[model samples]
Target: MTTKNVRPKFLNLFRIHLPVTGVVSFAHRVSGAVLVLSLPVVVFLFALSLHSEQGFERVSEILQCGWVRLLSLLVLWALFSHLFSGVRFLLLDLDIGMRLAAARASAWLVLALAALVLIALLMGVLL
Candidate 1:
């Protein structure tokens, strides 16, 4: 008797998985959009605080909260990831990282760079 073949149950198991570069590329665009939308509100608050000393002090106080600091660091991470990934994309467009290993290595590098930027920002080393 012949037996019928069964397909894999996992949706992704039979599919070719996207490499890390693909993931980073997709994340870069998403992060960039988040940054773009946030820019307006951030600048508005920034400008408002600059209008007077009291406004400045008020904004400063708001920024002093731990939650606010954490949010700012998260924003910084998104911005950093977008910036680094954009550069990676540009390099890829220039025919760089064409090999599988190179692409994976570059993706890891971008993640590392983003982490470094976030750490530095948290340490108050970069604004």
Candidate 2:
């Protein structure tokens, strides 16, 4: 008798469906990485904005570019996503929202809150 192979030959990430909690957890990690990687640029821009009149003007001009504004929005979204998800994780550590339903609800809530923040940021920037 021969046995058939039980393992998948290839993994397809796009076909995988993750629960809301899993999505939130994954987003938290990704956002954290985004924030960490962007820190140097953020600090440099901040310092430049404070250096002198020319530096301030240069920083402003850099930020005025369309792509730069889009990147800023992305970075801001990452910031809020990391923050809200972190808080949800902390509460989970304390035994809150441990039930399946509650966990899913909280995950959706985190995503919604992050989205709301992004909207607010967009309005603030555009107006």
Candidate 3:
């Protein structure tokens, strides 16, 4: 069987717009993945810091590097986003905001709260 006109499998998927709820759901999974993948590195750093005073100083020095600082910011974002989105999903599961309009609004509110919290945490870390 030969097809003359071929449509790419993901073409329509890429072209279509995702609703707010979908966006929130996507972000939630991405943030959770980042956190899960980062656990090993985080644990290593924590253990190194606890090894001795010198180890703690080394950990602090490593964190002071520009790339490490940026990575820390990303971790903060992942943590906050995961937390906020989890709460949203829990509420949805309970049928608290099951309506289409309420679901959309809650999705946006979670995103906004996560951004604000991330900014605050970054300021604390940087300053």
Residue 5 of candidate 2: its Cα lDDT?
Answer: 94
RMSD of each: 4.6, 1.7, 3.2
Worst 10 residues of 1 by lDDT: 8-17
For residues 30-115, what per-residue lDDT tens digits would candidate 3 score against the true structure?
A: 99999999999999999999999999999999999999988888888889999999999998889899999999999999899999
How many clashes does each candidate structure show, in the order listed? 0, 0, 0
Best by TM-score: 2
- Can you write out model 2's per-residue Cα lDDT over 1-127, one digit (the tens) per residue? 9999999999899998999999999999999999999999999999999999999999999999999999988899999999999999999999999999999999999999999999988888779
For model 3, the superposed segments whose C-alpha errors exceed 4 Å read: 1-14
- The total of clashing pairs for model 1 equals 0
Off by over 4 Å in 2: 1-5
Clashing pairs in 2: none
Candidate 2 has its poorest 10 consecutive residues by lDDT at: 117-126
**TM-score, one value per model:** 0.78, 0.94, 0.88
TM-score of 2: 0.94
Order by lDDT, highest first: 2, 3, 1
lDDT of 2 at 95: 100
